[model samples]
Target: MSGPVRSATTPSNPTDASDPPTSLNPILRGFNPDPTICVVLASGGTPTIFFLSTSTFEYFPGCAIYTSTDLLNRELIGHALKRRSQIELRTVKPGADSWASTLRYRPDEGRWYLANCLFQRYRPASDQRIFPRGFYVFTDNIWDDNAWSDPVYFGDPGFDQDLFWDDDGKVYLSTTTRLSDRAPDSTQKDLAIHISQMNICTGRTLTPPVVIRRSPHGIAEGSHIIGRNRIYHLFTAGGGTEAGHQGPDAPAMLLRRQTSFFQSLEVTMEFSTQQRGA
Candidate 1:
């Protein structure tokens, strides 16, 4: 279960309170967590619309999707995983189902994509929770419940998986990898961000996965990449998403590529602390 949803917007004049920017704390009330949102501008006579999707751990219909026009009022259009053939949850741990999903619009493809990972079935001998491959589903009819296609699986065993389509028409996948996966001596809780070129249609990796950056503090996940002005930026959370560890290290980090691609990345800035289920 999750808490209420709220957003804050700042006005141009900080002193202006007469008709100040207003928002409703818990605008969306219920068990909606790790919400990923995108906006589709008006085109071809279609009106502009905002789309949103949230993680639904151990729950049927995996990711819940919604749509809005002004970002306030929302409507439950459908879900990304609505059919039984789309997912299997019998072995999923109680609270470890589908989480940290991203929903994005591929303008060139004229379709929407939802990338998610399912954590299910634990390995008692190794004491490691096995992730059943990262997968993504696509849909052209946003409002139709049965429009989403079956998942296209990729061999990335990580959480908070994200998909980015670069300007050159190349698709990139980003996700977390436990430090222990590389250095067996390191703590398993520590995670590093990784990126790879993948075929969005077939879920095939074109390039070997590259470790872009390591978590600055405790853990790093929820990575998103975007390109603009001939520059690619990578955003991730650090320190820890859990509570009680809120401090200087708990801020979200911003890193950008040194060149046109993911050859090199450098830390450029840092932002607010992240709290899990808070």
Candidate 2:
């Protein structure tokens, strides 16, 4: 369930008792996690931000959306999927219906896109948990709940999938996967991040998935991609989510590709102490 809307801005002077309380904090509360935001500037140059968060086994009306004009105050716009055809949770276990998701606006297509991994319950008979499947849906109108298209399932790339639409009109999908068995790979054989060219209309990959980054600290997930000033940046979280147990490895890591959108990416920076959540 969602919480009351609150302001994100805070006052500069907290010591002054006479100063009015200007900060409300937390634009969203309650079980809301793994938020992805997309910003668009209107014709008048006013900034409009759209936010989507994981619902994770919650009942129908999954993945709520919030919008804000100034980034301080956010209003509950609506949900992207509202029908049983869009999302079915009858067979999913608690807290496994949906994982980390991303919201992206494609200017070329004039539509908004949302990509996420759907988790299924473990089968006791087979003693195995079903691999999470990644899917995406788009809507011409982001403000309407009924505008979202049916889920178009893609290959099970990994958890926390994200979509990156580059200026060259090519689309890419990034997700966590196991280290490739091919040559020139990481010593850590278990986990890595992968990216591939994706067809926005059919949710199909056109190229073989390439390993962009390998986890140095035993684990890595939660991939997000953005392009700015001819540079593409990828943000990911590793070393687990817990605080003290993470040891020396950072919670968040950054990788960059300046030459092209889908070329080799090198880790440029890392936040050792930052507590990044999926």
Candidate 3:
């Protein structure tokens, strides 16, 4: 589940009218899993930069950040969580501290937001509910590590949380529901995805959570919502987390919503699938 970031792109200047594209694979090396990348437009004389942030579980500076002007070369700029006051992991279980994160740059707000969850004190036998808290940290400047504000904690919905901005000036929070958080009689597996309107600045939920999609397998996480051409595209990872047991049931689904996101929409396609031999 851990590897480098690979990229395939054509040359900056195409020399011929008809030529095959070139590829630069493994652009960023090291164990960078559950990575989120975005393009930041250039301001003033600076070149447009591609920013990347990856999950750093149990690491001191959580959520390593990288930036690149071109797709070939990348630099480790800083981290989203740098200070001790930002995140505390004294007694957190190993390999279960910080989970997947969503990195975004808002042009209107002129800021960068990193949303993630902490799976700190999970004692299932004791039924203690003091783990899996979702929070976000913001920074006006991505280059400055100290500029990231303290985490604004939103109530724990689940892991692999996503922050999405709608056209009507509303921010929506999407996440996979944890099995422990469900009701006693609830039939939801570890695959349910929920959406809710939220106050992004204050980390406050403005509406009740709605069940959107449940994966066919028992696990569904890493869901992202993007809007284009008046249609909202939901890209979600469905199946097991590990590699050996993924089998033929593991597929990445693409669901589309033409109207409001709250409306019911059918699954449009099973866009990508990973099997044992495929």
Candidate 4:
């Protein structure tokens, strides 16, 4: 989906987020791949929501910070940690490993870490087997100091890592474990969900591995625990990628309508999920 991406900061030669007119169906435009979102209850009954966008291709991480009195049409407060992330991007793509991502916050340790995945020949758009486990960079108070912490690589999980926060002040990792094409069915475990506890605050992994959800089509690559209307909703995205990645040009994209909105993954593997369990 292409949406209007308004930007005041462009790397060197700034390009317009939109061409001439706004797009009709702008879903995830702005060259934003991995989207991490957080809703913070600010003082005076206000809520601030943050969305971070990364262009792993360019080896840069960029994000937009939006605030709201209501959830729809979140007001932009400018790009979140733009200057810091830009500088970090200059050196963050260490070696030949391209990056991938997921987002979450750690309450027990009072810090936030942007969970990411990286590897050699990392741009799976051309090939998929070369991906490797990656790291997390602790998000500092960049709003004030305009500085950043160094990225800390946490070693391989024997799989990829996408950070998920639980309800009881705990954090964890989830991902598609073994990427395979062999299946009795059309999908197999091709797109699966694996779970493990994470000490993200201390840059540690605290649990063994387990596969939680799998489907012929796919399970959402990301998950979140949030409170709304006095209840918790599990938000996730399932089955969607640009056609270029699926067959013709890029090997990364899979063809499926992306499901959005919230669901309940509190205790069971049930969901009012937008488009899943296919």
| C-alpha lDDT of all candidate models, in order | 0.76, 0.70, 0.76, 0.44
Off by over 4 Å in 1: 1-20, 122-127, 180-182, 244-247, 272-278
- All candidates: TM-score: 0.84, 0.81, 0.83, 0.56
lDDT of 1 by residue, 69-180 (tens): 7776677766788887888898776867787898999777689999998887534456554656889999998877699999899866788899988777788899887665
Residue 184 deviation, candidate 3, in Å? Answer: 6.4
Best by TM-score: 1
RMSD of 2: 4.2
Give lDDT tens digits, candidate 4, residues 53-165: 44344343343433333333334443333344333444333334334455455545546565555443433453334545656656545233234355555543433356655
Indicate the worst ten consecutive residues by lDDT in candidate 1.
1-10
Per-residue alpha-carbon lDDT of model 3 for 74-187, expressed as tens digits? Answer: 778888898877888887887678888999889998999999988876445544345466899999999889999999988646788999987878898998775445557654
- TM-score between model 3 and native: 0.83
The alpha-carbon lDDT assigned to residue 61 of candidate 2 equals 77
lDDT pick, better of 3 and 4: 3
TM-score-wise, the better of 1 and 2 is 1
- Clash count in backbone of candidate 2: 0
lDDT of 2 at 11: 54
Q: On a 0 to 100 scale, what is the lDDT of residue 52 in model 2?
A: 53
